[model samples]
Target chain A: MKKIIFGIAFIIFFSFLIVSAINMRTFGEPTYSEMDDYFIENAQSETGANNVVTSVVFDYRGFDTLGEATVLFTAVVGVVALFRGVKK
Target chain B: MIGNLPYVAVVIFVGLGIYTLMFKKNLIKIAIGVVLIENGVNLFLITLGYRKGAIAPIYTYAPSGQAMVLPTPQALTLTSIVIGIATTALILSVAMMIYKHYGTLDTDEVRRLKG
Candidate 1:
C-alpha cells in the first residue's frame, strides 16, 4: 500500500517535471544563435581557437567555469572532511 | 552518417549510467555509474564538434581551406575527462574509506555520515 502511494507520487512528480521542461521558454530574444555566429566568425582570430564552444567555455565564460570548479572542489573537500578521523 | 553513431552511443551510455545510479545500492556501483555518465557526456561533447570529413585538429595537418571538426569541444572534452577521472578517483577512494570504516558497501547501511 505504501509502495503504491510512493510510486503514484513519483509518477505525478515526474509528469509535472516533463510538462515544465516542455513548456519552458527563453525569457528574452534568443541571442545565443547570433552570439554564436559572431563568435564563430571571429573566434579563430580573436581567441586563437578553432572551436567556438571551447572559446566560449574557456575564454568568454572562464570565470563561470572557475567558479564551478571551485564549488565542486569545495564539495569534495567538505565530504572528505565530514568522513575524516573515523575508526576503521 | 557513421559519425553520428557516437552520439547515440553517448545517449545509451548515459541512460545506462543513470539507471545504475538509481537502482544500485552499492556505493562503488554508484561511483562507477557516475564515471559512465561522465564518459557519456564527454563523448557527446566530442561528437558535437565532429564533421563528416574532417581530420584531427592538429595545426600542422590542418587543410588549407577545407572544413575541419571544431577543436574547442575536443579541448573541453579533455578537461572534462580529466575532471571526471579526478572525481572517480576521489569517489573510489572515499568508497574504500567508507568500506574500511563500515565493513559494507550498501549505501542504505552506510548512513553514519548523513545528518
Candidate 2:
C-alpha cells in the first residue's frame, strides 16, 4: 500500500515537472537580461570589483548578505541553546 | 526547449529528496533530503542564467566584446549555499538534542518521547 501510494505520487509529480520543462524556454538564451548587462557594464567601474558576482553579493546586495549572516547567527544561538543544558 | 533538458537533473534531485523525506525514518536522513532539495533549487537557478559563448562574470578576463554569465543567480546561489549550511547545522543540532533526550534517532521512536 505504501509503495502503491508512493508510485502514484511520483508519477504525478514527475509528469508535472516534465510538462513544465517542455513549456519552458530554451537554455542559455534567456529572454530577460537587462539587469545582467547593467551589472556587467557597471560592476567594475561602480564597485571596483573585477568579479561581478562578488560585487553583486558584497556591494549591490550587501544588505541581503547581512540578513543571511544574522540568520546564521540566530541558528547558531538556537542550536547552542537547545544543547546547552546537556553535557557529559 | 531541448537545451533546457539539463533540468532533468533538478527533477531527479527533488524526487530523491521527497522520497527520502517521505520514506526515511531517520531524522538525519530527512535533513539530508532537505539539503538535497535546496541544492537542486540552486542548480535550477544557476542553469537559468546560462548563456551561449559567455565568459565568467569577471572583468579581468572577459573578451573585449562578449557576453558574461549572469551574476545575480550566482550571487543568489552563494547566498543559498550559506543559508543551507546554517539550516543543516541547526537541523542536525536539533537531531542531536532529540537523540540525547530520547536515546534514539528514529523519527517514530522520537515522537514517542515523553516529557
Candidate 3:
C-alpha cells in the first residue's frame, strides 16, 4: 500500500516536471535586441578568422581557452602522478 | 530544409553523451561519454559555420563574391578535435593505471583516493 502511494506520487511529480520542461524556453533562439555590427563587420580582419564562434573562442577569449587547457593538463598530470604504479 | 539536420544531430549526441556520463559506472565508459560530448560540441561548431548554399572557404577554385562557409569554426574545430583526442588518450591511460592498481574498471570499486 505504501509503495503504491509513493509510486503514484512520483508519477504525478514527473508529469508536472515534464509539462514544465516542455514549456521552457530553449537556447537556440537569438535573444540579442541589438546585434553587434562591429563583430560582423571586422570579424575577418580583427580576429583574422572567418567564423565568429572561433573568433569568440580563440581570439576574443584566447586567454580563457589557454587557462582552461592548462587546467585540464594539470588535472591529467595530477591523476598520472597519483596513480603511477601499483599491482592489482 | 534538410540543412538543419546536423544541428539536431549535435543536440541529440550531446544529450546522449551526458546521459551516458551520468549513468555509466565504468571509468572507460565515462571517458567514452566525454569523447562523445566533445564530438557533439565540435559538430555543433561545424554546423554553426555552415551556410545553406556556400562553398568551402578556399578561394582558389571558388568564384569571387561567392558565399563561403566560415573557416574560423573549422579551424577551431580542428584544434578542439585534437584536444579531445589528447584528453581521451590521457583519460584512457589513467583508466588503465587505475585498473592496474585496483583490478577493476568500475569507478565505484576504485576508492583508493576517495576523500
Candidate 4:
C-alpha cells in the first residue's frame, strides 16, 4: 500500500519535472545575461587576467571560495574526530 | 523539444538521484544519490551558460573576434564542486560510523536499532 502511494507520487513529480524540462527556453541562447556580459567586458581591464573564469572564481567571487575551503576543512575535522577511537 | 535535451538530461539525473535516495536500502547508495544530485546541479549550471559558437572566457592572445561563454556560472560551478566534495566526504564518514555502531548498512535495520 505504501509502496503504491509512493510510486504514484514519484511518477507525478517526475512528470512535472519532465514537462518543465521540455518547455524550458531554447538552448544556446540565454535570456538574461547582462551580468555575465559585464564580467566578460571588464574582467580583463580590472583583473588583468587572461582567463575571465579564473578571475571570477579567485577575485570576483573569492568569498564563495573561502567558504568552500572552510567547509572542506570542517568536514576533514569531523571525519578525523569520528574515526579517532579506531586504531590501525 | 529536442532543443531542450540538455535540460531534460539534467532533470533525469536529478530524478534518478531522488529515486535512489528514496528506494535504496543501503547507506552507501544514499550517499551515492546525494552525489548524483550534486553532479546534476553542476551540469545544470554549466549548461545554463553555454553559448553557441562562443569561445572560452579567456583573454589570451588568440581568437580576437569571437564571443565568450558566461564566466559566472562556471565560477559558481567550481565552488559547488568543492562543496560537493566536502559533503560527500562527510556523508560517507557518517555512514561508516553508522555501520560501525549498528553492524549493518540497511536503513530499516539501522532505524530499528536506534536507541
| lDDT, residue B3, candidate 1 | 29
Weakest lDDT window of 10 consecutive positions for candidate 2 chain A: A18-27
Candidate order by DockQ, highest to lowest?
4, 2, 1, 3
Clashing pairs for model 4 are: none
Q: How accurate is candidate 3 locally (lDDT)?
A: 0.66
- Model 3 over residues B14-75: C-alpha lDDT tens digits? 76676577667899999989999899889877765665466666534556675556555675
Model 4 scores a TM of 0.94
Model 1 CA lDDT for position B59: 39
Error (Å) of candidate 4 at residue B82 is 0.9
What TM-scores do the predictions have? 0.62, 0.90, 0.60, 0.94
Docking class of 2: medium
DockQ of 3: 0.13
Q: State the DockQ of every prediction.
A: 0.13, 0.72, 0.13, 0.84
Cα deviation of A39, candidate 1, in Å: 4.7
Candidate number that wins on lDDT, 1 or 2: 2
Cα lDDT, model 2, residue B97: 76
Off by over 4 Å in 4: B112-115
Please write out the lDDT profile of model 4 over residues A5-77, one tens digit for every residue. Answer: 9889989998999998877778888889999999999998999998999999989899988998898999999
CAPRI-wise, candidate 4 is high
Best by lDDT: 4
Ranking by TM-score: 4, 2, 1, 3
Instruction: Give the per-residue Cα lDDT of candidate 3 at B14.
Output: 73
Among residues 3 or more apart in sequence or in different chains, the pairs in candidate 3 whose N, CA or C atoms overlap within 3 Å are: none
